[model samples]
Target chain A: MAGKRGGNLNWFYLLLTVVVLTGVGLMVYGQVGRGKTRAGKASMAPVNLAAMAEPDLIKAARGVNRGAESARVEVMVFSDYQCPACAYFATNIEPQIVKEFVETGKIRLIAQDFPLGGSHIYGFLAARAARCAEDQGKFWEYHHQLLALQNAWAYSRVPPVETFQSYAVDLGLDAAKFNGCLNSDAHADLVTANYQLGQQAGVTGTPTVFIDGRQSLGPNDWDVLKAEIERALGL
Target chain B: MTAAPADHAPGPPANRMGIALLALIGLMIAGYMAAYMLGLLGAIICGTGGCETVQQSPWAVFLGIPVPFLGVVGYGVMLGTALLGLQPRFLADRRIAAVLLAGAVAGFGFSAYLTWLEAAVIHAWCRWCLASAGIATLLLGCAIPEVKKLRRS
Candidate 1:
C-alpha cells in the first residue's frame, strides 16, 4: 500500500514542476521585452512643461542654453537625469541633434530640470549636481557623463555624491569650488525652480521637448522629431 | 480516517536538521529585509553592485511596500512550522507534516519566481536574493521525504 501511494505522489510532484516552470518561463520572457520601451510612447499630447496660457519666449525659461542664444529655433528639454527614458534620449538621440542643428547654430537647446520625485532615487541630487557643474562652466560635459553612466550609480540607495565628485574631478573643474557648491546645495534652488516651472507648465514626465516654445511630439523616434524641428526652422 | 498502515509506523519523526535549517533561513531573510527598509544595504552587500540595482528598482515594491517584507512573513511561517514539528503533540496530528511540506513547497515556488525576475527583468544579480532562493529550495527538498514517510492511516 505504501509503494502504491509513493507512485501516485511522484506523478503529482512531476506534474507540478512542469506547470510551475512553464508559467514562470513565459511571464519572465514577456515582461523583460516590454521593460525596454519608454513611457513616452503612451502619450503623444505635446506638453508645455509650465502653465503659461501661451508659448512666450519671455515666460519659458531656457536655463542651460546649449547653442547660441541668438539661434532662430529654440528647443527646450524638460528632463530628469535618473529617468530611464530621459537617459535613453540623452545618450542616444541628443548627440545627433547637437551635431546637426545645434552645432550649425541654427538651433538653441535649453535643458531644464524636471526630476520625478516618486519613481527615481537619485533624480533630485543628480539634478542639483549637474547644476553645480553648470556653475563651473561644464554642465553639458557632466550631464553627458551622468547620463552615459546611468546604470553605474542610479541604483544606489544613498545619493552617489562621491561619484558626482569624481566626475567633476575628471572634467577638471576646481575641486574646491565644485565640492563646496555640491556639499552646500548651491544649486538646490535652481533645481527646485526648474521643477516648479515644470509643475506650472503641467508637465507629467521627463524628456518633454518644446520647439520654439511649442511642445513637440517626442524624443523616442528621431525622424518625427527631425521633421518637427525642420518645420519650426522653416527648412 | 483509515488506521496506520502495517508497512509504516510514521517512520521515526520529521528530521530535526531540516527544522533547524528552516529557522536559520528565516533569520537570514529577516536580516536582509531590515537593511533594505532602513536603507543600509550598500555598506553590507556590494559584491557585484547588482544588489543596489535590484533593491531600488520600481519592481522592488508590491502595492507601495517593499516585496522583501512579504518574504519576512513567509520565513516566519516556515520557522513556526519547523519549530512546531519538534514536539510530540505537534507531530501527533497527521496533517502537521503535510502542512509543513505544503508551506515549504509554496515558499519554494515563490522564491523561484523572484529568481526569474532578478535574472530577466531586473538584469541584475543579488547574492542575498539568490541565497534566499537556494534556502527555500533546500527546505522544500527536506520536506518531501519527511512527508512520504508518513503512514497511510
Candidate 2:
C-alpha cells in the first residue's frame, strides 16, 4: 500500500511539472514572437551581387515590360505572384523603383513569372491571367491588380481565375477578349518561358531581382536599391 | 488533490503504457507549437527551407490562427484526460479509456489528412508535422488495447 501511494505521488508531481512548464513557456514565447509576425515583417534575404561581374543592359523579356527598349539599365525581377515576400516587394519597393528610375528612363523594368509550386495554388493561374490581360495592352495594370488583390483570392482552395477576370473588367479591358484568352490558355508558353528563365538565373526564391546581370543582395529597402542602381549605372 | 489512502491496491497497475503514450504525444505537439508561435523560424524537428515554406503557406493557418496551435489545444485536452485518470480510483475507468480512444482516432485522422496535404498540395514536408503524425499514430495503437482492457475490467 505504501509503495502504491508513492507511485501515485510520483505521477502527480510529474504531470504537475509538465503542465506548469508548458503554460509558462507558451506565455513567454507567444508574447515575444507575436509582435514581429503581426507587423508583417518576416526577414528578407539580402540581395547578393558580389558573385558575378555586372553586365550591360539586355532587352527585357518577352512579357510585360516598362520603360524604353534601349534603356541603359535593365532591372529584371523574378517573382511568384502568390508569395508574400514578392507582394511586399511589389507594394513597398517596386513603386519607388518605378517612380525614380523606370519612369525617368534611367532603367527598364521587366517582370518575369516564377510562381512557386505546390502550396501556392493560384500562382500559375494568376500569372496566366496577367498574361491574358497583357494581350490587350494592359499587362502592368493586371500585374498590379494581382498583387493588390492578393488577399482576396490567393488562399482560396479553388483557383480564383474569375476574380482575375473581374479585375480585368475593372481595368476597362475587353472582357470577352480577356475571357477568351484565359479560356484558351493563350499564354501558357509565355508563363512557362518566364519560369524557365528564372530557374536558369539560379533564382530559388521569390522577389529575386537582377540589376543588369548582378543579382540583388536585398532590395527590400529603397535606399539600398537606389545605390545598387547607381553602382550599376556608374552614376 | 484526491490522493488515495496507503491501503489501496493502486487500481490494476494504473494503465501506465496508455497514460505515458498520451503524455508523450501531448508534450511533443505542445512544444512544437509553442516554439513556432514564439517566432522560431525553422521547424523544431528539421528543415532545409521546406519547413519555413510550409509554415508560411496558406494551409498552415485555419481561419486566422496557425493550425499547429490548434493541435496543441487538442493534445492538451487529451493529456488532461490521461492525467485525471491517473488517480488510483479512476485508473481503470472505462469512460476515460473511451475518451482516450476517441481522441486518438480523431487526432490520427487529422494528422493523416495534414500529412497527405503536405505531400500532394504543399509539396514540402515539415519534419515537425511528420513527427506529430507519427506520435498520433502510435497513440492510436496504444489506445485500442487500452479501451479493450478497461472494458474487460
On TM-score, the leading prediction is: 2
The lDDT of each candidate is 0.69, 0.71
- Residue-level lDDT of model 1, residues A73-132, one tens digit each, is 988888888776677678777998999999999999989998776446578899988988
Question: How far in Å is the alpha carbon of A87 misplaced in model 2?
Answer: 4.5
Evaluate fnat for each of the predicted models and list the values in order: 0.00, 0.05
Q: Worst 10-residue stretch by lDDT in candidate 2 chain B?
A: B39-48
| Number of residue pairs clashing in candidate 1, backbone atoms closer than 3 angstroms, sequence gap of 3 or more or interchain | 5
- Candidate 2 lDDT by residue in tens digits, A25-133: 8657865685554233322433333332123211223546799888899898877788766776788888899998888888999888887776666788888888888
Off by over 4 Å in 1: A1-62, B1-153
Residues B1-153, candidate 2: write the lDDT tens digits: 475666765443344445555555566665666576555632121113566556656678877867777777777777777766565566667887788888888989988988887887666787778888887887787677666656677
Candidate 1 matches the true fold with a TM-score of 0.53
Error of 1 at B97 (Å): 21
Candidates, DockQ: 0.05, 0.13
Candidate 1 CAPRI level: incorrect
